[model samples]
Target: MQPYRPSPSPARRTVLRGSLAASAAVSLGARPAPAQARSGRPRAAWGVQTGDVTSSSGLVWVRSDRPARMVVETSATESFRRPRRWEGPLLGPDTDCTGTTALRGLPPGTQIHYRVTLADPDDPRRTGEPVYGTFRTAPARRRDGVRFLWSGDIAGQGWGINPDIGGFRAYEEMRRLDPDFFLCSGDTVYADGPLLPSVTLPDGRVWRNLMTEEKAKVAETLDEYRGVFRYNLLDHNVRAFNAQVPSIVQWDDHEVRNNWYPGQILDDPRYGEKDVDVLAARAGRAFGEYFPVRAPSAGRIHRVVRHGPLLDVFVLDMRTYRNANSPGRQADDTTGILGTEQLAWLKRELARSRAVWKVLAADMPLGLVVPDGAVDFEAVAQGDPGVPLGRELQIAELLRFIKHRRITGTLWLTADVHYTSAQHYLPERAAFQDFAPFWEFVSGPLAAGGFPANALDGTFGPERVFVRAPQRANVSPMESPQYFGEVDIDGDSGELTVRLRAEGGTVLFSQVLRPGRVGQ
Candidate 1:
């Protein structure tokens, strides 16, 4: 992945008072310190994580204290010793001060412990706090079955009381099940619009001022996005859980600006030149800084990751490269949905895929039908289906691609809709059978704030199965404010079980989505 090289904009120091104040105040045992909270070196942090148990490789990342070379270590245990190792230099700010090291020649499915050490130019004792973490590789390519988790939209406001509303509980419950790795469907952080003025909590006093409403109505900006991300990452449980497993992420509306269509800069009347561009760039920069992704391809938001033969995950960028949002636009069927090039790429990958299962991950629902019995592409944008023919052609191309490919073992995961539910759709074959069989698991709001209901039955047409959790299932007992999804594949039996769990440790729903096995 190449580093970003945009012209430097004025760096905005994020206001830590509302989001990071408590942590800083407790750490310093004082009211507050200006940007320089501590007197020494900057504290270490990590973000945007993913990994695979390659036949002979593994990867790791951490934020740098300065532009210096980093040493990456892997061991069978936390105690570093005669285990395998790799080292690399994080060239410059292009990396946004984050370092990625790919270590090679490791055993498969090995629970190798790892950490990064910062080396200084002059100091003899240049090092970091071991930065302890762990990851395992994929099973042999021919391995029969494998399991992983997937979910999205985990966040609350930067200053809200119940920050855990965005699936913080889901993170804790997921730790107990401990799947191979997790999939962040989309909307990992709602950077919303620009950074607004955070209500100052000076002297721990909550003000009931009318100005708060005035600030709320203002447009979104870069600072707001950064503050939201900073606030979310501050959660200790989220950080700890991520340290143990690799998480693959793709962004949705909230990451940039809400309900944003390509070229539509949120509420900007000036279009391209508005604050939307600035905010988008900032959110992307922050996402790069905090997440472990292989950079966006050609300004198009899409990429594919292979987890050996067990699964092939396609992460798509639905926001970028989208046609402008409006009514009566021209229909260039060749360029919508996945765009001609990206759609072609996706089709080629699907045809060539030898993995047991293929997971298509998008930020929004693919087959979502609205109240009027029509696919509402512009529900967020109101009645204007903008360039209706173009959008429909895009949908047609995708449907044709899926049907022609006979792509079984393909499951869909999405976020941005704060709910936990799923439905199976099959557009191929003469008759439209309810059990035609392809599942879509939707999870969001790590700390859910919106109302959730039976979205499964509501979205995917009238007839859909709503499975109940089995009695005596060995599930967690804690109450979860956030929601998430999980899938477990038993290689020996070829059984892939998927489930949605609430923060309260209760299994909201579960289904054994058995691929390769039909009927009794």
Candidate 2:
């Protein structure tokens, strides 16, 4: 799917308005059927979700128990008796047999009830039962008091002795928070649902395929990426969560192939990866179909949305433009987390924003490093499993930019590296490393894995100045893998309180971030 951009023609608005006027409560658009009618249950599919809802439109997504055309409708309220809506019949092949229809003419800052049904393209009488859900449009430019959830790295199904660790339990707990939206930092799915796949080559010989690009990008292949998303979305808690609220999503490596960088897919060595563009194209297609994301732009995951006076969120594409992790014992200063184009766009957005809080919704950590002032270029070069390389330099530039523009009310929220912690960077400090104090809160993995106790103890970076001297500011509390992070803002006071919660609504950690705390 092509990236979403408003049409510029004078008749563009007329076309949109006309398309939105097809029906009172529900309307169907022109859609051609797939080559064959689908019959049989989707390998792993369930859940009715809404994504990328602007003041006037939103995307409705679902997969049927059986391959059939699907219809989605939206209404102004729960009792859809009289409401504006949009609907479309979908063919179940190109988009993983899943359907994503766009709903238009929705009012801003309002909640609407929606339903999805498996329909028969030729005979409308034979259709599956409709599934009901809810969604909210983005608030108007003058609105305020918005809230959302941010977390990452959910545990997936078990393999051998390795148990499943997913956000199923965490999501259940987050339901109580009633966030308007949620952001996944990455690793949202475990490709190894039944367990990591052990591939037997074309020659009956066995090989391990992480399902990275090489193994699955061929015209026909379903590896970890597909399997993981299948299983993750199947979780009742996840489906229920999505059905209840709209989500704005972007992916990390797990969504495609694990530990993938800009041009490389971390697949097994035996299989040759498909061309980068082809593989990336497939991954993008699958992700757009499964998640409620706005269509992607050039296989890149970066976009910005303003939620009235409450906030301005910039979702980044860290994996698409990164330099190859760091090669051996060297730092690739030229490598950037945000490609030059994205970086330029980010600067302009940052300078032009008018919201009270501007959040950089990063998929990886932006400001944390090894405590001993050491850089593990080897692990980085090899594309270490959990380390965030190039983040330091990214933060350096980000902090400098913030300082230069004198932007206020800024914060960084990220996932990946499946743990919870918060650190601040201040570049004006007396200590060389503490010269920058910008706060970052890292949250992830609804299910914790073998992450060691206090793993970040001595790993605090110099950017942080502990509220308590001598004690580094980078240390995080020991918490369950089943945790979610939240940002609750008190608009009148201009105070933002971040809370880290465990399953069952347990508040494990909390911090209050204020204005003028950075670059002081």
Candidate 3:
């Protein structure tokens, strides 16, 4: 249970004036609220997180509230002195009390400092009261350059957490861009978007919503998808951006409902579980027992997350191998969306990558066209302008095997069509061009509700150049502004630079590239 390496907002005001930083989007503090135990301990109140990491290993989530025992320690300083304990796992309820701990060796790009506490599984001297966090550990040196922050939809459609604007505040604006990790890039949760403790807004405002009872609906049980992953840890900017970022999480199809595939069958009556593979196997075992990954299988997510010699990050779980939603002009499909053994394990991990930025990440949005309704097709360009049909013939066989294996620095980050973009693709503006010319980009929802900006499907000819969306559709997040995506790289100019920010981090659009380039 503890083997495999491992690895791995609240607010106030405003003050964003241009080109990136000057700070002041307010409230990046507040983390109290689990006191009053005095002695009988066993707490952890939803905080400590870290994931995937690599280089020397990582991982360390926590969740307790009872039956405790997780212990974790680690330290590179935060005054933890000679630390490095680890032990974790036992907070039961069959994974509801959540757990995850792996640590191992460590010391790659430095700065670790963990914590966690929680004992009392029968009184090992009653513990609890630790919780701190910190990350960073991938660089083995390419001159140590790489940064992160990709986004995802969280608490969607009915948009939860709104402590008068101090909640899920775009995860404290991508945790003040401290990024060493965080890719999420999917609908982390929206398990069919529920919530509602107030709404009204068509302009009259109102919004509100902090709801819980499994977010007031839709998540069909496995403890209602572990209470929608403990409802974004009741946000303090998503637990202070999971205590200083370190994540690689993946999953699309709203984490379990909208646009769900893999033998889908629910005609949606708000589900009594008309089997969308039994509500995606209880929302993928409550999203792998609340996200520190490993031990997943139902609706299995894809893998690869290297991060060292300058990024690898493949991630993609395009909904557990697919081929459902229709109208994608099936001209003899072969499980189109990454299905045949995850397309031969992503063409054998992009032909044994040696890292220099591969990052396919993607959870939808190949060329956008998203529809799933008026005729099926829920992603991977089904608005076909001809040629490659059905999930663009498995992304045209992984872009003709990365252009006949000349693979170099791939790229293609994504987030389900919720705004922010940058396409590019070409082979002379394709309709099925055999490949070489990349860059996909696309940002996200971070704190849900923002739509508008979908159609582009020229069977991968792409070329959007840069978008910013929201002219309507769901909107609200105090009326639009919450997208992410930022890259960086550049260790003596291996140059990657992406940007596309917003919601106080601003930058709105940027591009860069260069590094054994294919399309610039």
Candidate 4:
């Protein structure tokens, strides 16, 4: 297969020149540091994070305020009395002064305390303030318990960094939970959502958002897309949270634009460019550079994460391999969601996995009706109440394969709806009955607009067991309810407990299911 390459655009060239000029200015001390960077302090602007963890290895990510050589020191002790140093990738203008390093030969189930150091690329003698972080590697033993948090949609709907009382307080609350890692389902950044300085609420009160030049408009240039990622790092709460907790991130529509797909021409007035593919290419590159995810082998982000004998997380890249959102039926309708290659990979991975529980960390829901304009939109449900059509055909086939293979203990977790809900799918009550019954938990919008509930399609028999949505649309985080989900898997009994939490760490719903009893 040919590698997926981004097409060249004139806007991308302009972005490159701008970034290079900015880097040169920073190096010469002609420009001041970013708002988050203190005058006297060292240049660790975004703090540090660890991610993509396994039993014996992990990845650490850092971004500097200027060009620097990145270095990491890890130890079992937090005091750093005895540490092992690992040289990291250079933080340069190419990747917007950001880089990542893979740490290998880590001890499983052991807490690893680490600190990041940035020094002058030319002179290693001058170093900056060290940012500390800790991560417990995935357990190699089967009896070790597992706990992680999952959420999505950050800094959306004109909600940007608020310097008043630390931006995005939900992250601080999530950090306090002390989970091993965070599964960021999607919408890590909203390149399409422009940030304004302030807006008046319905009650006549003014809400303020900390704004930057790049975030004030739609991200058409590469620097603008990179700025979308950089904008979130300006928040102190986000930085502190990242320094303490690792994350497994995926991208959704907002990461490029609202409900974008391949080869679709956007008609939104906010965007100057109508080509969705060009925007997606820039967004994809920025997302890869900013996050700690490994490079995809097949030019797609669909991969499996095995956490010993406890769980296997199948992170699906629904957006990359999806067909355009349109209504059609032809002799060959194979151009659906997941495509052909990804669906085959998913089935093979599911069949070969030996973990007690399989978690499908999907970016979009299976039965939710997400309509675009007046006609069609993205997601598995094509609004067809009868037989499967469009993406639903691919989903139906996958479900049938799972049932045929008797893949047990599989649960789906997703976030894109900007609400919290627990859904149950029964094969007997559905349009399709070849698949086994399963549960899907939805939670998200860590700090974004709160939306109302969405209707479900009957193609897969999704019943809302519990749902919590805002009464109004586009509600602010100050008065609106934000949500996240947590999963805890018992070591001995292999029971998985799922919890949907609100802004201040309140559990809205809770359910516990054993491995063998999920479908039943």
Decide which is better by lDDT, 1 or 4. 4
How many Å off is the CA of 375 in candidate 4? 0.9
Per-residue CA lDDT of model 2 for 1-520, tens digit only, reads 1111222233322222222221111211112234355453222136577776666677788765445677766675555677454556465554556777778767888777776666666666677656677756767754345667888765432311111333255665665456767877766654323343553333564433233232233222433334345555534556666766677787776555555565654445533554444455556666666676765434556888666676788888877776655432234454566677888888899899877788888876643332211433211112222222344445456566777678877888876655566666443331224234557776765543424212321112424332111132212112233557888766566677887665555566677766544442
Task: Provide the TM-score for each candidate, comma-separated.
Answer: 0.75, 0.74, 0.36, 0.90
Candidate that would win on lDDT? 4
lDDT of 3 by residue, 1-520 (tens): 1111111111101111110111112122222223343346766666767888888998888877656789988887766889979788887777777789887789899877677788887767778557677788988999878888788988788888888888887776676666788889878888788888999888797988877777778888787777777777767667666777789898888778898888878877877878788788888888988888765644467889798987799898877778788888877778877788888988899899888879899888788788877888777787768788777887888888898888888988988877888988887888788888888998888788888888887876888888998888988788888888888888877888888888875687788888886555
Q: Model 1 over residues 1-520: C-alpha lDDT tens digits? A: 1111122111101111111221222221111123233333323443323353354565566654345456677787655677666775552455545556767777776666766565553442655444556666777754545667777765433322233233254565665555667888776765542223333333554312112221233224434443455555556446656666677777776677565655554444523445555667766776665666554322345777777767788887777656544441345646665566777888888888877777888877654431212443432122332222545456545555666667667777776656556666543321223233466777755643443343222222222444322132111112224577767766765566777766666667777766653221
Give the C-alpha miss distance for residue 501 in model 2, angstroms. Answer: 1.3
What are the lDDT figures for the candidates, one per model?
Answer: 0.54, 0.56, 0.77, 0.80
Task: Indicate the TM-score of model 3.
Answer: 0.36
**Cα TM-score of candidate 1:** 0.75
Clashing pairs in 3: 6-58, 7-57, 7-58, 8-58, 8-59, 9-236, 9-237, 11-27, 12-27
Off by over 4 Å in 2: 1-45, 65-69, 141-144, 156-167, 192-224, 265-281, 327-332, 370-391, 429-436, 448-450, 453-481, 515-520
**TM-score comparison, 3 vs 4, better candidate:** 4
For this target, which candidate reaches the highest TM-score against the unseen true structure? 4
